[model samples]
Target: MSELSIFSYLPADDPEVLEQLQDRIELVRHKLKFVELVPTVACISSLSPLKLAGGLVPELIRLAGGTPVELEDLAAADPQYIIVALEGSPLNTAMSEVETLMALPGWESLDAVKNGRIYLADGEGHFSDSPAGIVETIEMIGEILNPKQFAFGYEGEGWIKFGV
Candidate 1:
């Protein structure tokens, strides 16, 4: 048992923590009330290799109030939202990646692509492999999914629109 485990770090047994968590949950729920329905989201890590969602990626999408689905599902039915995660900063490369993905067959048919719901995630210290990146990632995803509620720019915050 590592002392640094999430089980030990979480304040699961603390009533105050629970109350605070509940409050935040309620706030998020209230903010999303006008959303009507959550969209199905697909996360793509790469275009050439065709890497798809797994691990924290799906969890982040869920926290953002979108249903995470596999890339294969995109072929069967298009997802309403798409998140493309880049390796690092220098948005030129990220934009190129998005262009490459859009060039793929059937990609243009996706509702997300047509509706401008496609996004790119890349920034220094914004998206990290460490667990500490979860909060920022969730926030970024929330802003992307519901800009009306989480209104914020993504340019310097590790996220950005594919062309905008």
Candidate 2:
């Protein structure tokens, strides 16, 4: 199994918090261990179980072009894309929150993950102030996924294609 990079901001010092975290981690590890090959797209998010299980989860199934193991079930889980789905303001607005998640044990230690591909999936459309905002968002994901494949520019009217 490759390194597991977890995205979370749950405090680690508290006993109750630690126990819960350990339990969740164990579950995730167990699940990830079942997968056998690299998945096309892995939707990594901290969304509520209901929202993730009901919505994003299914979309990811289709996006992956093959079966995708839950974040917990990934065995060789050196994540290629760390997709962050946030509501309200852009994820950049919550820099501290992002940093906290990055500081989590698994994420902080993963040296292989290239930086800045950190995605800010803003469904609230808060960045509509800039007509090219969607393109910028897509560019960020592209950069994080593969800098060589995507050019950093707005393709008129927020059209974007990240080398997925």
Candidate 3:
């Protein structure tokens, strides 16, 4: 669990709010536990230099029924879905960044690209490190990864999926 990160952003003295958020997150996790398809997913935190995410993001992916693609093995990982959420970037800016990422040499070679399973998230609110945002991010990714099984109404605002 990323309780440390979520709790740090919240009030240190207010344990009640933290406890409630934790319980909510656990409920979401339990629901995702029976998910049928655990797809490979890669989360990109940067665009200019092509920096992939690590640390807490991957744990959230696992909880949302996905296997986080290894940062060092992007090509071989063949991730089924890719989420790009540059920090401080809104949905529009993230869309532009997705265009930049698509221009990379082997971008189309990935399974995600070929299948049009790529997604762009709003960084400011959707993928932030705050307690409530963290829980929403899980639902956002869960809806993207398992459309048939889960939908927390984060489709248009929090994230937008690109379909080819």
Among all candidates shown, the one with the greatest TM-score: 3
Q: Rate the local accuracy (lDDT) of all candidates.
A: 0.65, 0.38, 0.78
Between candidates 2 and 3, name the one with more favorable lDDT.
3
The RMSD of every model to the true structure, in order and in angstroms, is 5.1, 16.4, 2.4
Q: How close to the true structure is residue 76 of candidate 2, measured as C-alpha lDDT?
A: 48
Model 3 bad stretches (over 4 Å):
1-12
Q: Candidate 1 on 35-127: residue-level lDDT in tens?
A: 867889887766776666565567567666888877554666588888777544545566766557867668777888788887877633444
TM-score (all chains, Cα) for each model: 0.72, 0.39, 0.85
Positional deviation of 17 in candidate 1, in angstroms?
12
Task: Evaluate model 3: give its TM-score.
Answer: 0.85
Candidate that would win on lDDT: 3
TM-score between model 2 and native: 0.39
For candidate 2, give the lDDT of residue 80: 46
lDDT of 3 by residue, 91-151 (tens): 8888876568877657879999989899989887867767787778878888898887777
Quality of model 3 by C-alpha lDDT = 0.78
